[model samples]
Target: MDRIKEKMNQLRLEAEEASTKVEELQAKVKNLELENLTKEQEITSLSHKNSLLEAEVEKLEETVKTLKESAAEGQAHGTQNETLNRRLQLLEEEAEQADKTLRETNEKLRQTDIKAGHFERKVSALEAERDQWETKYEDMAKKYAAVQKELEEFQMEIGNI
Candidate 1:
């Protein structure tokens, strides 16, 4: 009957809405997960750079120690002392540059952590939304099944008539 057809149409519409909601939630989750992954990679890269900077700092300190020792022994000498002083100044500059790079890398890592936290929260929220969509879709599916059964019975009755 016309009434059964209208009921079927409404049920289908509700089901479609639920389906769309689920799809949207899934997309949000996917995008957030990708962003989180990128943040993790950046963090890893920053950590590696930190290690390299630490190593450079250690090497510079060793060179400075050796230069000071040579300067003490060469107090009687002048020409090589000038060369050692110049090399020491260059090493000091390299140390300062390395320290600056290390600080910048740390700052970047901190910012990345904050962004990653935000992404994690968003992903969690989207997962909750996905669960909500799943519940709604389940409810709509049940309603649709009931409507289908009722429509089928009605059709049978009309046929019999």
Candidate 2:
């Protein structure tokens, strides 16, 4: 009986440890989800920026095309000037800036992907741990019930004596 009680106590302590692990896992899950949400938002924001950059690139390409046509017309008319040269220089600078922005956005997207992968792995590990704890708890509960039943039977025998 004393051994059964000791087992019960041991089971209780193990249960407490399991409970603590569950709470910790829950907290980690919540935090990870929040971080995932933040990363998603960042990805969304970067996508918007990418769209805007694409639009700007289209606009710049159209401008460059128009400038080329204008330059051809100006050469035919003997009307060339420094102003057209300056406009071409500005357009080149804008194109370079757009390319740099695209590269940076791609880098940020890659980093978000890495973080999401890490979070997924952690969640999977926690789920496995939780399952293990559930199995152990059930096993302990069954053992405890069987011990209680045996103790009751012994008490009844004593009473009849």
Candidate 3:
């Protein structure tokens, strides 16, 4: 009976040791499950952040493309403005030349008018001299007629003597 009791006590100790080991294994399994759940949640959060970053990168690419197009348009506009400025300068120079030609024509017209007035005065003086010469010729013809009549009377008196 003493030996049976000792054996029974030893079996009880063995059973308690087995129970503690089972409990420890159960706790370790629960810790492992919790760690897996935390890793899953972190993976999901990181995936969402990566997607957001991809969208931001796409937006930046589009903005860069738009800026490049605008720069090209600005360069074209600058070229057109330069061409227009050159054409306008040429037109201004042509206008200046035309103005100078008009001034020269007006000066020539003024000189022509002065010459016309001088010619008119000379014509008037010539007409007055022509009238004086015609009157002198008429007086000389009357004196010659009187002297011829006196010579005819003297010839008739000499024939009677």
Return the TM-score for candidate 3, rounded to 2 decimals: 0.56
88-156: candidate 3 lDDT, tens digit per residue: 999999999999999899899889889888988888888777777767766766766766666676777
Better of 1 and 2 by TM-score: 1
Cα deviation at 33, candidate 3, in Å, is: 3.0
Tens-digit lDDT track for model 2 on 52-120?
A: 999999999999999999989988666445666777899999999999999999999999999999999
Which residue segments of model 2 deviate by more than 4 Å? 79-161
22-128 in candidate 1: lDDT tens per residue?
Answer: 89888988988998899999999999999999999999999999999888877747867798899999999999999999999999999999999999999999999
Give the CA lDDT, 0 to 100, for residue 83 in model 1.
87
TM-score of 2: 0.47
Q: What is the C-alpha lDDT of each candidate?
A: 0.94, 0.93, 0.86
- Residue pair clashes in candidate 1: none
TM-score of candidate 1 to 2 decimals: 0.50
**Candidate 3: which stretches are off by over 4 Å?**
1-25, 116-161
